[model samples]
Target: DKNEKIYVSYDSTNKNCKAGDIEMAEYGHPKNDVGAPIINYSIAYDMTNEKPLLYESYPGSIVDVSQLKYMLEKIRGYGYKKIGFILDRGYFSKANIQFMDSCDYDFVMMVKGRASFVHGLIMEHMGEFESKRACSIKAYRTYGMTVKAKLYADDETDRYFHIYYKAKKQASERARLEADLDRMEAEMDKIKG
Candidate 1:
């Protein structure tokens, strides 16, 4: 098992909790409901074993982007070498990326599609691999292509951007957008009346 690549998925969620002796249970941005004390719970999950490797609790006021360095240090302290990370969009930030790069850890992070750099990449590479059978990932039922570039202007390392397209997901998202637009239009008409 030591020779195998270790991949961990890191994510966090807020849970409503009573603020008694627990100092971390403070009111912050609640993911579920507003105006309640919450505690942030994060987990590092072993992707290969399909189980959690570790969990940590932190103040709800702390954002995900700020916790990456601390979590990475803790993980490394556990004697895990040759580790890779699968991170969510909330953890995507210049500082976090740089910290990970400094530690020399491999990671795949979800980038916001609306980010200018990401949008530009999508526009530049649009339609290049979507219809190609060779680009299809059968297991995920999606088409994917990779782009290599520096994340920062002065970075010594080249980062790879894996762009994927799923037709079913796109159709579902479009339907949701249309429904939302219809509802907004009706609300505006009622307000005008």
Candidate 2:
């Protein structure tokens, strides 16, 4: 929980991990997507109130949550207790949710519209987003730190999106204007005039 004052961090990658040594005969053969080579990385943080700790590294997908569960369980063996797994949208999945629930752990994760339908439901309530000064307490109670943030709605989809925005902070306003100018120039270039 943000109110709990805990540690936070992230994991990412710039290159793909080698799937495996290719067989001499399989050099150009069709390959499994997992065997097609995807980037692999992970992040771990110590979410013990006030103090922050973060660690990240490349650990092939095979050692992912399986290793994570092993490590967390071992930590419990050494006597550590915790709550909620916070993760990026890539790590969100029905299986992950079920695993966490079964293990008595709560979590916070961003949902990607490409991966799940939950994002659509969230979009439905975006117009009623709570302001920075105003929050829907009852919604929080029901959704567990989840709230529909008021963001731009898509005209075709009518989907609401929550986004972080500076309230007219000058630096950001200048940046937005610069981006707009760039966009206009690009549009002008595309025209047949």
* TM-scores for every candidate against the unseen true structure: 0.83, 0.44
Error of 2 at 112 (Å): 1.4
Question: Candidate 2 — what's its lDDT?
Answer: 0.46
Per the 3 Å backbone cut-off, how many clashing residue pairs does candidate 1 have?
Answer: 0
Cα lDDT computed for each candidate against the true fold: 0.88, 0.46
Q: Can you give the lDDT of residue 31 in candidate 1? A: 84
For model 1, which pairs clash? Answer: none
Worst ten-residue run, lDDT, model 1? 18-27
How many Å off is the CA of 69 in candidate 2? 5.2
Using TM-score as the measure, the top candidate is 1
